[model samples]
Target: MNATATAAPKAKANATAPARGRPVLGRFPLPLRVLGYALVVGVGLVYLLPFALQLVTGFKTDPDAAAHPLGLVPTTPTTAAYQRLFGLSQAGDGVPFLRWLGNSTLVAVLVTAGRVLFDSMAGYALARLRFRGRSLLFGFVVGVMAVPGVALLIPKFLVLNSFGLFDTYTGMILPLMVDAAGIFIMKQFFESIPREVEEAARVDGAGVIRTFWSVVLPMARPALITLTILSFQGSWNEFTHFLVATQSGQYETLTTGLARFVSGGLGGGTQYPLKLAAALLATLPVAALFFCFQRYFVQGANSGAVKE
Candidate 1:
């Protein structure tokens, strides 16, 4: 009886021992953990300080902004910058902020939609379709991704001029509609989906297009959402392409317009408040998109990381 009681207590202790040991395996000392947390917080503040300054500077007068560029609070807060951006100022010839916003929204939407469709289709073909030279075509796609975007600017400019697409909405959006990185991302994700799922669709008398559209595309929601977010963000913030693609003020996007406006386009003496206000507004849409779809984005990014 004594031996049995001792064995039971030993087993219970053994069981509880691992649970206790688990905590100590990768645990840091209390002081070290506190230091690590402090370090992380300090780094976070470093990254966020500039944005805070920009936000506060937008409310300051030009003289105030110049005087206290790094201040978090304005000595004299004003809404003149916001008023000017929205054309609420008495000046009838305010900056064409609405036109820039509209152009960015329209182009971002169109480019995002086109990328979602064409990139997915291209990725699907590369992943699932069997054909001659398929490997070579996919290799070409991957190679294109390695090519520097800046290198293509002059070529893109020449092509747009030749095709009469320069200075048009089509010119601004067409070149950005399909991206190699987007195609690569979609291909990697599509390859991770089960072939049996596609086989069942085919067994149900579905053609290639029907199967891809109805069955596969629905299951690719995470990747599609990720692609949509990236495409919209890229096109919205795109400047170099828009710079060379169009020559007219009518084709100006938020990025291009803001660049010109901040760089003395309006012939100003350091309009810091107006410049910072416009940049802050331009950053909001992309920030909102990523936060909303953050979960799906993480899942999509890790889609092909492990195999079943």
Candidate 2:
């Protein structure tokens, strides 16, 4: 009887014990932890290797790059590629680097601004407004997102040609100004905000436009930043759309200019140094933006996780 009583108390104690958590890396056996670290390092190196090679190749001479394709050290470093890009040398090359840069900058800026304004307006309306066919409109937006961009290339070309917008900045920027995905992103984010906030704004005699512009937009900084980054990156790197929309060399952006240069359009033979240098310069702006606004990007990603 004493043994049975003692066993019962022990069982109750076991039942009341807190559950053990999963084992952390530090708690693992030393060899397993070492293996995990090695795996992570290997993956990191794999990603960094290409960038390292690109940086080194950009400084290499054309012959050196061809001779040592995989080498991370330039045999003879030269600034000739950069010099050509900036028009300090080879003035007759006809690459029009400055013009390409200007075009890209103009289009990217306009597209980003337009997406931010128009996408946010549409998103807010869909999220907060009581309008006819609201569900149907949202469904259409979602459907547009599902359509592959490549499939619309022919149709976009036709539309531009019909409107006489072909080979113009308007054609390039207008087609990209408001992306369906951006609208969806803004809509989802706006919906996550408290409805009571809008009610209070209304109670204070604020109209729809005033409430959206003055009250809610300020609180949507994370989502707005996310959309801005996406818009900038997408429009900056856009190649296929520009290809279909514009035919003139005068309208060529960085992507088209780079493509032509690489394909011997300006009379150079496998100029890896020049190509890599241009690519590196093109990548810098996006990289800088990402690093600067990484925190807001993370917050935007996590915004949809919680309801209120």
The candidate that wins on TM-score is: 1
Q: How large an RMSD does model 1 have?
A: 3.6
Give me the displacement of residue 166 in model 2, in angstroms: 0.7
Q: What is the C-alpha lDDT of each candidate?
A: 0.91, 0.90
Summarize candidate 2's per-residue lDDT along 27-142 as a digit string, tens digits.
68899999999999999999999888888888899899999999987888898888888888766553478888999999999999999999999999999899899999999999
lDDT of 2: 0.90
Weakest lDDT window of 10 consecutive positions for candidate 2 = 16-25
| Collision count for each candidate, in order | 0, 0
Clashing pairs in 2: none
> Best by lDDT, which number?
1
The TM-score values for the models, in the order shown, are 0.91, 0.90
Which 10 consecutive positions of candidate 1 have the poorest summed lDDT?
18-27
